[model samples]
Structure formats: C-alpha cells, structure tokens
Target: MFPLVFLTVIALDQLTKHLVRGGMALGESIPAEGFLRLVHIQNTGAAFGILDDARPWLIAVSSIALVIIIWLAISRRIGFLDNIWGRLTLGFIAGGTLGNLIDRAYYGYVTDFLKAGIWPAFNIADASMVIGMTILVFLYLRSEYPRSQ
Candidate 1:
C-alpha cells in the first residue's frame, strides 16, 4: 500500500506538471469557474515562494528529508507505521518530496499550477506533502497524549 500510494502520487504530480509545461505558456492562467484557475509557473523555493533564491539549499534539504522518510518507512520503528494512516503519511510525504526534488534537480525549479483565489500557485506534490504532514501531526498528538475517559 505504501509503495502504491507513493508511486501514484509521484506519477500524478509528474504527469500534471508535464501537461502544464507542454500545454501552457509560462505565467499563463486559465480560469476554471468560480475562484479556481490553472496556471503555469515555476517556483524556485519552498511553499508560498519562500527562499526563492535558495535552490541548492532547498534541494539538499529535500533530499535529506526523503532519505529519512524512506528510512522510517522501511524501519517501521514508529509505532504508528503499523496502521494504514501511518503508511499513507509516509508514502504521500516521500512521494511529494521526491516529486519536487526531481524538478529542482532537473530544472532548478518546480512546475506549479492549480491556483485558487488569492493563494499562490502550487502543484500536486505540495498538496500531498501538506496532507501527509497534517495527518502525521494528528497521529503524533493522539499517540502522545491519549484522551482520558
């Protein structure tokens, strides 16, 4: 399940980026009913365009994070890894990390699209990483301080 989820996220992320890169011009925007829109832009930094000038540093950090995520997934040392949510968390995070890392390594930037309202443009990998981290935090808190009856 972990491998499946991981690969699926990577595949979807790469596929969408590829499509956006090939089909749309850089900075192009296509309104999609309401406040949603598809955009073609490159992000050279982390979330919300932070550290836009630190490509090399961002890549190094992402690589290290990927390694640690893989290690934890394989080691299963974390008690939560025994559950489905844990597996999903690792899979999504690892997949997302690798997805962006690939872009940073190959193009020195990440291809981002899927914009909405006032939010900056982002890709599937960002979404996956956010979702995974959110779940992980919830799990950690639940395990650390179980509710008392």
Candidate 2:
C-alpha cells in the first residue's frame, strides 16, 4: 500500500509537471473557470519561494529528509506502514519529496503550476506534502493526547 500510494503520487505528479512544462511557457497563465488557472513557473527555494539562493543546501536537506523517511520505513521506527493513515502520510511525504527532488536534481528548480486565487502557485508534490503533513499531525495529536471525556 505504501509503495502503491507513493508510486501513484510520484507518477501523477511527474506526469502533471511534464505536461505543464511541455504545453506552457514560463510565466504563462491560462485561465480556467473561476479563480483557477494553469501556470508555468519554477521555484528554486523552499515553499513560497523562500531561500531563493540556496539551491545546494536545499538539495542536501531534501536528500536527508528522503533518507530519514526511508530509514524509518525500513526500521519500523514509526510503524507508519502498519496504519492506514500512517501509510497515507508516509506515501504523501515520500512521493512529494521524490517528485520535487527529481526536479531539483535535474533542473536546479522545481516546476510549479495549478494556481488558484491569491495563493502561491504550487505543483502536485507540494499539495501531497501538505496533505501528508496535515494527516501526520492530526494522527499524532490524536494518539498522544486523547481528548478529555
């Protein structure tokens, strides 16, 4: 399940990035329906374009993150693979990390599209990472600190 979800997210993310790169020009925007549009842009830094000049460090950090995730999975540190939500979390982070990692290694940047309203333009990888992290936090809090009855 973990591998399946990871691969699915990576495949979908890469496919979308490939399509956007091939079909759109950099900085070009094609409006969709309301408050939605397709865009082609690149982010060299962390989320929302932070640390714009730290490509090497960013790559190193991303690589380390992937390693730690893999280590945990293999060693069963978090037992994430055994739980459904945990698997989802792992898959999301792994997939998202791998997706952006590939772009960073190959292009020195990550491709981002899928713009909506005032929010920053982001790709599937970003969405996956955010969703996965959100799930992880929710689960952790639920398990570690039960609500008062």
User: Residue 108's C-alpha lDDT in candidate 2?
Assistant: 88
- Whole-model alpha-carbon lDDT for candidate 1: 0.91
Which digits, one per residue and each the tens of the lDDT, describe model 2 over residues 1-149?
67887999999999999999999999999974458889999998889999996888988998999888766655656642447777778889989999999999899899999888888899999999999899888877777334542
Clashes of each: 0, 0
lDDT of each: 0.91, 0.86
RMSD value for candidate 1: 2.5
Candidate 1 lDDT by residue in tens digits, 22-120: 999998889645588999999988899999879889998999999999999888898866588999999999999999999999999999999988888
Worst 10 residues of 2 by lDDT: 73-82
Q: What is the lDDT of residue 71 in candidate 2?
A: 69
Model 1 misses residue 44 by how many Å?
0.9
Each model's TM-score, in the order given?
0.93, 0.90
